[model samples]
Target: MLTETGKEYLRYVTEAFDILLLGQQNSRHAAAAPRLMLYTLPSLATKWLLPELHNWRACTPDVDLALHGTHAQFDFNTMHADFVICFGEERYAQLEKKFLFHDEVLPVPSPELIACYQGRKLLSKAPLIHLEWVNERRFLPNWRDWFQAKEIEEPEPQPSFIFNLTLLALHAAVAGAGVILGQRNLIANELASGTLVIVDELSLPHSKPNFLAWPQRTLSQPGSRQPIAWPVELAGTDS
Candidate 1:
């Protein structure tokens, strides 16, 4: 009972709808592919989880990852990163926080420097390498807090170097630049390998546990998968 024109119109509409559905499915699949951008503290990136990140690539072969390291105060609103890894005591109200692990700060120096300071009080005269978080108000970690926790007074001014990145400080310490307050989790390998030596058994309490945080509303997105399992697995394996 339908005219030829009506039949053609119906056929065309059905084909168009099928194409649209197919296109939508393809778009979703493309979006679901494991592409993640992670913003983290520089210390965590260069020192602690660099190797683990390589391993993550191995485990999730389909993933495309971009890592950014900066101060914890980075603007989350402008960041396109899928996730953030940072250390803090309090969770951001706008983000979903997952506790990764706790870190302890230890004093570290090169082997030669340790030998030079052997059998002497650590703070006797040697310069201490300082990693300064210039923007301390934003919850960036610092060496002052660690010293305070141990009830140690700040050393008198001496020849010193200040670095924004923890890795640079670690490298400088390893290169015999100065004594650094190294994170146990970050410096484990260097300590074990004798590249760096712990000057004392003293460790300072960390300001916060390492955590994975993502935008609260974006938690359900497919790209959010990497942050969840990666940190959990890393922490578990570390223990």
Candidate 2:
């Protein structure tokens, strides 16, 4: 219904509107506070980070943090995550990495179980509860490793129950299901509440250390790099 010139003019108008809409969308994003997405293991977020979120807020009040708890690796290109907390010294060719902490694991059992075993010399007979590492490739400390660290000669006891998550394993121990080689940092609440008590005086080092990694592109964004720096600054903090 239109001539060639009319068709050209119509196309120009359509392109202009498209460009305007895109600019508005971008402007909206720019006007909003800068938000950073952080991906880490499920248990770390709930057991370690959640309690200390108040400190994080106090430090970076302006920037928003989107904490995503996941066991699976995410693609930076697709996921748009600003940072990742890995279980080991994960070397990414394009990402900058820093060490957080290598926590220790100790045998923790419910107080009720301790009372049951009171005056007994060998606490090794108590049922062991195991936490299955989601990533089989990474070496995480287990009951066998703890026993070796403690120089125990007897055969490692089989786990009464195995849980896939640290929280579940901790809960199982709290419920008097069995003893678990709980990370010292993760079992703070249970220990404080007297629901769980450390079996031995010695603690075994965790096989792998936790690391914080971020893509190089993260540094390019203004006001984005500061929030992530807090982790390294507060490395030894339980929260």
Candidate 3:
């Protein structure tokens, strides 16, 4: 297995090759309409990206867009995306990165589920849908961490449902599977639409943040690729 340093060096090498070839790629695109390839976390793609796509299409009709989704690290060389939405503050030190946003973890359940629970204690005992971080990402925000943040003990396992993807955990909760300690930004539409409602008042902002990253060549030729313009006002509350 490779150390973290080894992984970063590999990313740098890939980016260097991409920059070296960007001019040739740009020239090819100059012959036709501009196009962009974007890779994003699965949850962000389903909850936010898909809902706001019409606006993205309307805003940049001159550009052709293709989207890809995953919860794992991406190889820019193979993905062929102009930019990627990755979870964490600094995925690539050599590549240019922008702070898009991060999630504020909060307990959300279907309105019907809310009806069965009275208070936080009862809610805690209810089925707790969990986003089980896989790979080396176990340190990412989770219910156990959030409980610690609140200065409370971890709840019993309760044979709770576990999912690798946050989006799936949230979907299960919305379908009344259980209460999910969901990211506010990712579930804002459901909260707004009254499909899912907050069960606990306490909110735990994710220790990690999300970011948008692009090659240096992308900034040099901004006209060739337009990154996703996430709405500032619609951004989820932090506290």
> For residues 176-215, what per-residue lDDT tens digits would candidate 3 score against the true structure?
9888888887887898999998766788766677777777
Tens digits of per-residue lDDT for model 1, 76-119: 68857777786773545567777788777777889878767655
| Cα misplacement distance, residue 70 of candidate 1 (Å) | 2.3
Sorted on TM-score, best first, the list reads 2, 3, 1
Error of 2 at 222 (Å): 3.7
What is the TM-score of candidate 3? 0.76
* Candidate with best TM-score: 2
Candidate 1: list runs displaced more than 4 Å: 1-32, 72-77, 89-91, 137-157, 237-239
Question: Where does the lowest 10-residue lDDT sum fall in candidate 1?
Answer: 134-143
Q: Which pairs of residues collide in candidate 1?
A: none
Which candidate, 2 or 3, has the higher TM-score?
2
TM-score of each: 0.73, 0.79, 0.76
lDDT of 3 at 235: 45
Clashes of 3: 0
